[model samples]
Target: MLHVRAVCPAEHTAEVVELLREHPGAAHLVLHRGAAVSPEGDLVEADVAREAADEIVDGLCGLGLDRTGGITLEALDTAVSDAADAAEEAAPGEAADAVVWQELLGRTGEESRVNATFLGFLAIACLLAAVGVLTDSPVTVVGAMVVGPEFGPLAAIAVGLVLHRGDLVRRAGLALLVGFPVAMAVTLAGVLAGSAAGIFDPGTIDGNHDVDFVYQVGPASFVVALLAGAAGMLAMTSAKSAALVGVFISVTTVPAAGYVVVAAVAGRWDRAGFSLLQLVVNLAGIVLAAAIVLIVRWRRQRSAPLLRPLSRG
Candidate 1:
């Protein structure tokens, strides 16, 4: 549910109330008339909770009340009043706002700034993973997993496909293309610096044939990427972010990228190829998974009707 706070002219209170009364999903309508120091000094304020916030806003806009004042909607954790529900039950109009293509596209743009940070984090994560690989410590590797930030671009890509926004598609693609190479280059520089300090020995990386965890890349990795991508998308779109942490751990982009850096420093061409393959596979999986999610969301929106009239006796 969402909490909506609207400030309108005092004269428009009856129209706003009538509109709220018509919405079946809105509850807890509180009207503050002759409010002092409001949006305008003489504006009235209405506080309400509605199941379909987007729809309610749309209806209110349609009634020309927006010209008189502004409305703000915020999501609330608590329940609202029964009278609000009764009002929605009695109202007539659309059930919800039809999915707005431009809005989804705009969201993708907003997501890019977040992706830039994720990319920088990915570089740092690879450094951590390299440390873990050097020490053969699972705990450090897990830390790297938690720190990696590739999920943001992955989620953005998914949202782009769902919304069919070309702008989003372009932005997401740009982030991925620029982010990975920059991260890889930074990791490579870190490896060179570590070697000069004698903290990292390219010799150890070259000699460690037993470290199967760092050397091999295969179809299994690609499959994991695909699954992780889907899970990441679901986590972002749904209200369940807490679960995405596990998905980050399950994928190998950060770990593998770290290994690639180590291999480059050690001159282990074979291992570098393998690690690069892992990165490619993981990225592909994420993109494909996101595309699938968008398709589903688009289809669902297409199938739903816009408005249904209420019976008037």
Candidate 2:
């Protein structure tokens, strides 16, 4: 479905070919050798499917093929030649790559950290959701969901658990701990400002306004969170990143956090507690669901047969 292009030194062509031949999911491998003109001159050009690109890159790196030479892999937009698949089949190699367990663990850990960008987006999302809460507009609430960036850390936590990465667990936990409070505080401040300006009245809390949607968190919300989390994790690991935007908008964390701010400003402690509960329920459901999905994937990967090098015919 995806295409991959790689360039390596000509002298390392044999190793590259052998690596691709062993990868089971990889097909349509094309190799053009002695065409590059770098400072060293004449490298090998390889084109492959996007599905197998990650495995191939990891394999070549493991074989020390990149130490002296160079390897670059990129996704292609168009279909490749069928002849490339035939050549890969005829090649003499196994169908597997060396697993870099430590590197995988490290990458998983890095993905879970709540970096600056995530915090910034969370701030904006919460502020937007605060406006939605004040106005009781479902449309604006949905917009806040679309803009929130909380899914990355949650997915990172799931991957971390599957890989048993302590660092990832810590980082994800820290993000959740810090992110919610900061967002809530900002929303509270916004609510206070709106109230002071007479744009929003604290008395609106009791008015059974059509926007009472903020107070009705239940099992359906949990289900939505679970589905979004699963989709989010898949998007993170797979090549399709656009799907993540949908997942972000499908959950209610931002809206619930914003509701808490509104309630705090209105001096309605009970409503604030209810909104906080909704936030907790949503987050718990998402994290648990993502963890389950990752665990299943890890198990499947472990049970797969290891490929052996092909015997010379």
Candidate 3:
């Protein structure tokens, strides 16, 4: 279930109440008239089932509430009310299967930000993977994968393409187009510095059979990425953080980037080239697979609001 808080103008409060009253999934509606200070409007709140969130959010936005006021959604971590249970039952689909497009777009928009924190996470992930690659440590490589934030932007790109939003697509693209190269550069610098300090032997990366899969691009790499992509999008839409970590660990994207760093430092262009190819293939596969998953989900839900979030005009 989701807790929806919408600030409605006094004139729209009655209409909003009527809309909520008529909707089966909108349970326990509360209207505090003339209570909003920031927006100076009536505060309307409700407990809405996940399956019905799209419709309710769209209805609220269609009434021009988003422009004049605002609406916010928060997950009900634990809902003990019988009303919530009945609301979920009355909704059209299962809560787990529902795709709240507005919430998803909002989430992806944040993930697409190419900010300092985003770059720092990516760079640290690459550096960790460099250690794993050079030391031939599978455990370290998996740890690196879990630390990588690359999936966030990849999922954002998929969401953008699915929604046909140019702004989101561009933002997410910029994150990837710049994030990977910057992370690789940072990882390389770290590796060179480590070599100078006798802390790492970059030349050992060539014969490290344990982590060789990072540079080896075969059918399995693409297949795993495709599967991970689908899972990642599913996790993103459902906001399942645990499943998302699994998706991250299933991909070779970060490990490939780390491999590229170490291999290049060793002057093994052949290994570096393959690792780069691996990186490209993994990234492309995830984007392609995730886009397909989202597109299919959108198409299958014929009742879902199409571009309702984009109906600002």
Instruction: Extract clashing residue pairs from model 2.
Output: 2-50, 3-76, 22-94, 22-95, 22-96
- TM-score of each predicted structure versus truth: 0.73, 0.74, 0.96
| TM-score comparison, 1 vs 2, better candidate | 2
lDDT of each: 0.65, 0.66, 0.88
Residue 292 shift from truth in candidate 2, angstroms: 1.6
Q: Rank the candidates by TM-score, best first.
A: 3, 2, 1
Model 3: colliding residue pairs: none
Among these predictions, the greatest TM-score belongs to 3
Winner by lDDT = 3
Candidate 2 lDDT, tens digit per residue, 85-150?
A: 654454333223222233334445555567777777888888888787777677888889888877
The CA lDDT at 162 in model 1 is: 58
> How far is 43's C-alpha from truth in model 1 (Å)?
8.5
Candidate 3 on 209-312: residue-level lDDT in tens? 99988988999989999999999998887767679888988989989999887888899899889998999889989999999999888987766556555422
Q: Number of clashing residue pairs in every model?
A: 8, 5, 0
- Is 1 or 3 the stronger prediction by lDDT? 3
